[model samples]
Target: MSEGPLDDLDRRIVHSLQQNARKTSASEIAEQAGVSASTVRNRIQNLEAAGILTGYRPEVNYEAASYQLQTLIVCTAPVPEREVLAKKALEVPGVVAVREIMTGTENVHVEAIGSDGDDLSRIGRDLDEIGLEVVDEDLIRNEYECAFHGFDVKDV
Candidate 1:
């Protein structure tokens, strides 16, 4: 991704923040990014105001939270009704994340979590209940812990 007005120092601060947002301090961020602490603080605040920095959150253990599964459900629906389908998909429980991906096969990628196998199964069932034309579905059993990493949690 292209860095808009973010200089080298700003980029460094962003990278460090992305690695661990909650624990990163302005002074520490400045040291890592090679800038003044105030600069780091101001930049972060500015980014937040611009909707670039969303919020700081800890990486919670899903298993500890009773969430034990992750599945990437690749789905296809009518192109004209894509917005409607996306809206309906959001209502399904256990669906933590959803994206309208541009791919050769599917138009949507749903990243969801469930309490167990049966919970994930219900996610698929719920989608069907809402009338989404699921051409195919792929469920990956999250055996170990998992983390979400994307630009949504960071800016370039």
Candidate 2:
């Protein structure tokens, strides 16, 4: 519910990083966050150490690539079973990420990519073979994507 103990400068630095981590230089972040380059570097190190900033990776567009079909599979399983099922889901062809949602009709949300209908069907069968039942499935139409960095910094 709260971003614990993050001062104004910390929030700004984080926001700048969230916008563009790779291309944005320390001086640029310092200018935006209203700090010096040295300050930006120091704060970033501290943020990494504190685990607020873990890692950065580029977002991949599955449709633009060869993986034409993207899907979200909602699955229900006990918490204990959920983790194992999540890990196993990764082994299934075209499955990208499996998230364990704490609250939902299903506890596991599998983000998957497929080339066609057969690939999608194989995923369902793969899950069934692993004893993970998919309660629902939705094909992603389009994505209007942005990086929020997992926080709201408007009033920071």
Candidate 3:
């Protein structure tokens, strides 16, 4: 694992994995980067060891999975306690993800999936019980993601 900063090859590997980690193979990425398969594999291991490459998670379609409602709950917690509260929020049923923002008001954002309004209400109450003040919420209709272009090879 040679380290100073990520070189061009490293960036190209990351970009390719970000595009589709589940489907893309080391040989394919190596071919695109003009490197060997083992090189690509070692780079991926080093990236993970350095905490640059995190876990690979599937993109789930909650609505299609019979969880009809996807809600984004915006809440506020004391800045000092925000991180702790965010972790606690995850323990609540239906809560899928939580983000702690830097601002004072509406500093915590929680993503939750439920079957209906009742499920959302239950989650909201649970959050409140854990000391988060629910400020606002909205139904999440869609989401999208793309690989970072800064890591892309110009001619790939």
lDDT, candidates in the order shown: 0.71, 0.83, 0.93
Per-residue CA lDDT of model 3 for 1-156, tens digit only, reads 324578888888899889999999999999988889999999999999999998999999999999999999999999999999999999999999999999669999999999999999999999999999999999999999999987887553
Q: Pick the candidate with the highest lDDT.
A: 3
Count of residue pairs whose backbone atoms collide, per candidate? 0, 0, 0
TM-score for predicted model 3 compared with the true structure: 0.94
Residue 82 alpha-carbon offset, candidate 2, angstroms: 1.6
The prediction achieving the highest TM-score against the true structure is 3
* Candidate 1: segments with Cα more than 4 A from true spot: 1-3, 141-156
Candidate ordering by TM-score (highest first):
3, 2, 1
| Candidate 1 TM-score versus the reference | 0.76
Deviating ranges (above 4 Å) for candidate 2: 1-3, 147-156
Model 3, runs deviating above 4 Å:
1-4
Which residue pairs collide in model 2, if any?
A: none
**Whole-model alpha-carbon lDDT for candidate 1:** 0.71
For candidate 2, write residues 10-70 as lDDT tens digits.
7777777777788888898787666799999998899899998999878788888888899
How high is the lDDT of residue 52 in model 3? 91
